[model samples]
Target: MILSWRKKRAARRAAKKQNLEVTSNMELTIPSHFRCPISLELMKDPVTLSTGITYDRDSIEKWIEAGNSICPVTNQVLRSFEPVPNHTLRMMIQDWCVEKRSYGIERIPTPRIPISSYEVSEILSGIQTAKDQQDAERCREMVLKIKELAKDSERNKRCISANGTGGVLAAAFKTFSKVPFEQNVALLEEILSALITISPLDGEAKSYLGSDSSLHCMVWFLKNGNLSGRRNSVLALIEIVSSDQQKIDELLEIGGAIEALVKLMKEPISPSTTKASLLLMYHIVSNPPSSANSKVIARLTEMELVKILFEMLVDCEKSICEKALGVLDEVCSYDEGMEKAYGNALTVPVLVKKLLRISDLATQFSVSILWKLCKNDKSEGGDVLVEALQLGAFQKLLLLLQVGSTDGTKEKTTELMKLMNVYRDRAECTDSLDFKNLKRSY
Candidate 1:
């Protein structure tokens, strides 16, 4: 009996010790460095930022993808979006996971980036060689490969773009301009697709692209290429010229850039493509034109841009309406653009309907457009006023005053009301206005 009791006690003590060991293991604290700054959890894939801070790749990528330019840990602007993988830190985390596996920690495998720096550099070097050797087939294959790489992931897109992809491709374009446009459709499409995959092209790339050959190449794609090619060209132009007046003038000097853009807008392949064209138009026309570009405004008039834009304002959703009105407002700032807007039968009604109905931005643009049309109408004793009064614009302007608006918008509203004060009794109108609890983030 004594021997059996001793054996039972020994077994009970062993079980208690094992339980204590398990409890201690569960209480082990994760090191600060092992934890991601963003998630405050053990990192699965560690990467070092240019700011010299480490974060989990997933966390940092999510931050970057959200359009943040600053590092979360350092609170400093990230010089480069590229995050170098910290293999050592990742391994350390993996080892810790293994050590705690009995406590339910799972070891993570090695994480892969979209592409390595070496791979990107090699492809770029090959592209340069193909361009120099005038190997059209080799160049096409190389560029298509790049497009495929860009499509792999956003990280790959940034990786290839951050390298010399744009410069080399620009050089390729300079060479390929000698090729007949019809023959190089696939090649040009691939090039633009690759560039577009990494949009907001860096300054170096933009400078490289801001040349006669590049502009004319995109113009050809815009005018003559297939639907996909056309959309890609316009999107490429938006990233290329952006708001640079000099580049805009150069693109204009290329002759068919504006015409091709306008034509695409008229016969759009899709809503997204049409929206892209509108953005490009806004970028080009909104910027101050160079002294040598006197015919820019007249060209817009000749293209019937005002009617087209008003039509877009009439049919498009709130997002597109805002873009269309933004471009239309800029176009109407000039005498020629104003002449086009004036001739449009739906101009006043559409502008009035857009007010307070879309967004503060749309309403502001509509107000400016209305003010211009009204001022332009002063010669006819404000036909714009009569139309605006008929469309209940007077009540909307009053609402703008009551709800409050930007100083410029308010001033324009007051002026419009004053201009139309004499015509208020001429037309019967309803004062009903519902904001629908519309919220604006701007």
Candidate 2:
């Protein structure tokens, strides 16, 4: 009986020791497993699961809120926990943004053409070769080829350079002009025909023929061809002439070209076409050929070019009206003899009408032309000046003068003042009673 009791007591002690060891291991392992990898802290706000596993609510919430529900250490996803802490995740995102901003990194859009050193060197070599060649015919052919290859290169360079367009056109013109006379003529004709056939291409090719080169080409065609043969060719060429005053003067010197352009203007066409033709005619007439001014003026007056110009000035199309006024401005700059030839055409009344009908620039140009007419001190213009004052032209002129004073239209404003004084002085003795008052009103 004694041996049995002793054995049972010893078994009971061993069982208690084993249960304690198991409990101790469980406590250490559970707490360590639930701890956050990032925070490296004991888990808090403990939560129990169906699988008999327990985890801190704060740690699980953080894991889910970070867009990383998986535990970093064990790689076990903790998706079955309670709601994530949104406020904490927002703070973390803000901190991440601040860290990125401190690095001075920015996302920039990429450019279309990423030019490199090798490509640039190749383009420079081609340009130099094109520029150095002396044979115009060979150079011309090469230039066209170079232009095709450099189209993209030019586009990329234009982003960083201002003279890119001029540089390209200059290279092309130099090549085209160096060809032999006969060859150049053929090339010019080809260019013109191409321009006509592909009307849309003209806008892009305009820079190809520099204004000076185009003027020379037109003169060449006009001088080489018979009057009838040249008529249509010159008419087409007229559309390309630059509106620059010097270029217009140069073009007017060509034989028979002016008359051809004037005839085209009189025909039925679109307003833009008619306007261009009229402008060319006006420049030609105003500048006149250097020699035999009287003969040219007589022919021009007989042709009634002044009447056509006045009618165009009153056209409803704003562009037509503006261009017509520009033409009138040029014409009135002619010498006294030309003015006399124009006197019989009754230009002032039409000009006065333009003043009220057009916009500011047109009005300014028309008034300028009127001032030029009066500056010649002709008796016919004196009568017109008196009529103008009666038509309230002086009042509008004075108002423009006042506005011009503040706007710094020094030249225009001074011209207006001079005109007002001229009208006042000229109309003093006239029978027009309004002019007499206008003389005193200012």
lDDT scores of the candidates, listed in order: 0.80, 0.52
Question: What lDDT score goes with residue 345 in model 2?
Answer: 39
lDDT of 1 by residue, 1-442 (tens): 9999999999999997898687766777889999999999989889999999999887999999899999886789999988898999998889988987766678998876668779988998888898788777888898888888888777788778778787778667766765465576667677777777767677766765666777788888888888888898888777776646667777877767788898888777898898899998888787765444337878887988888887666667877888899988888888888877777777877888788888999999999999988977845556778868877888899989999999999999999999889877776664433323323211
Name the 10 consecutive residues with the lowest summed lDDT in model 1. 433-442
TM-score of each: 0.74, 0.43
| TM-score of decoy 2 | 0.43
lDDT tens digits, residues 28-121, model 2? Answer: 3223443444465534334433333444444554555568755554666555534332333333434443444423322222223323345545
Lowest-sum lDDT 10-residue window in model 2: 433-442
lDDT of candidate model 1 versus the reference? 0.80
Error of 1 at 246 (Å): 2.4
RMSD of 2: 24.7
Model 2 alpha-carbon drift over 4 Å, by segment: 1-190, 196-254, 281-299, 336-346, 405-442
